[model samples]
Target: MSKRAVILAAGVGQRLQLAADAPAPKCLLRFDGRTLLERHLRLLRAVGVEDVVIVVGYEHQQIADELDRLDWTPRPTLILNPQYRQGSVVSVAAAESALCAGGDVLLMDADVLYDVRMLAALVADDSADRLLLDAGFEAGDEPVKLCLRDGRPVELRKKVADGLRYDHVGESVGFFRFTQASATRLAQIVRQYAQTQRGGEPHEEAVRDLLLESPERFACADVTGLPWLEIDFPVDVIRAREVVLPQLHPLL
Candidate 1:
C-alpha cells in the first residue's frame, strides 16, 4: 500500500500565461472556488494518502501560505527545489528522502484537474509500479504516453520511435505508484540528472529510463472517459473549468 505521495509543484509555468487573474504558481488556480492544490490535497487525503511532500519553487512562499490556510490534517512536508527552472526532474529528485524512505510513494504533478476516481484507481491498485492512463486524450506530441504491449508498459514518452508496436497506448495521467525498491532506484536516477547537464530534461526521462530498463516492473490502469486535464496552456485552463470540473464528483 502506498501511504505517501510526492507532488511536483515547482516549475515557473512560463507557458501558461494568464491575464490579471493569473495563479502565480499555477497550483493555486481555482476551479469553481477550490484551488488545484486544495483539490489535490483533499482527494489524496480522502483516498488515505495522508503523508504528502510537495516540492516548491517559483513563488514558493505563496504555496506555503496556501498550505497554512488549508491546514490539512497530517501536515504535508514542503521541499524547495532550488533548480526548479532547470527541469521537472529536479523537482522530483528534490524529494529524494520522501521517495526513498517510504515503503511506497505516489508521484504526482500538481497542475492537473481530475476527478476523485482518478486518485481512487491508483490507491486501490497494488502493483509495485503503476501508471494511470487515459485513452481519450487528444492525439499529439504534447501528452506523455504510456505504450503497452500485452498490457505491460514498455515505453513512456511523448513520441514513440519508428518501428515500435503496441497494442494499447494512452495518455499518462502524470500520477504514478512506485514501490519502495523502485522508488529508491528512481530517486537515484534523477538525483544524478539533478547534478549534471541533463538536469534540463523533463522528469519523464527518469521514469522512462526505469520503465524501459525493467518493463516487467510496470503495469497501468486505464481511466479513459474520466474527466481530467493537465492545466498547462491557457486553453487547458478553460477546458478544465468548462469540461473537467463539471464532470467531477463534488467535494465532500
Candidate 2:
C-alpha cells in the first residue's frame, strides 16, 4: 500500500531576509552538506514515498534551477503556485491540483524537520484524518497550537483553552494523512480561504477551521520526544544544525 505526499514549500521566509548574504530559500539552505529540501526528499524516499509533489514559489525558478543542477534522480513533480504570494493555502491548492491521480495525501510544510521514526509513525497510522502532535510544551511557545478533545483536535490556533492540553512547538511536524473526505475538505478549505484574499495570514488558521468544523474525523498521532524543528529565522538554522543535522547524518 503506497501513499502520496505533498510538501508546501512556496512561502517566503521573511525572517531570513534579516540576513543579506544568505540568498537561498530556507529549503535550499544546507546542513551537513545537504540542502533542507534534499534532506526532506531523501527521508521521504527512504520511507517508501515516491510520488512527491513540491509546491514552489518565492524564487521558484531558483528552486527549479537548483533541482536541475543537482539533477536529483527519481524526481518528483514540481508545481508552481502563482498565488504563493497570497498565502500558503494557495500553495496547498496548487499541490492538490498536481496530484494527477487520487489517493491519500500526506500534507507537510517544507520548513519543518522531523525524525524518520516520527514520519514512519504517522504514515503507519491507519486513521482517516490524523495529526502528529507534540503534546509537550508551555503555553504560547508552539507556533502552531492544536486544541484537542478526546485525543483529537477540536480547535486549532486558539491561544488560550481551558480544557485543552497545549504544548506549543515551533511547527506541526506531523503529516496529515487524508482520507477521501479529508482530501476534499482540505482542498475546499484552501479554495475558500484563497478566495477571501487575506494575504499573508497563516495557513494554520484555515486548517484549524477545518479541524473544528469536523472534529470527529480527526485523530491524534501524538509524536512526543521526536527530533523536530521549524526553520524560520537564523536561530532556527542554528537549531537545525545542532539538533536535526546530527540525528539525520546516518540516514544521509
Q: For residues 116-173, could you state the per-residue lDDT of candidate 2 as single tens digits?
A: 7777776775556777777664456545666655566665663645665643332345
Task: Please list all clashing residue pairs in model 2, or write none if there are none.
Answer: 142-168, 142-169
TM-score of 2: 0.87
Worst 10 residues of 2 by lDDT: 166-175
Model 1 lDDT per residue over 42-127, tens place: 89878988888999998899899888998887788999998889989989888999988868899999999988998888877676
Count: clashes, candidate 2: 2
- In candidate 2, which residue ranges exceed 4 Å CA deviation? 161-171
What is the Cα-based lDDT of residue 238 in candidate 2? 86
Please name the candidate that would achieve the greatest TM-score relative to the true structure: 1
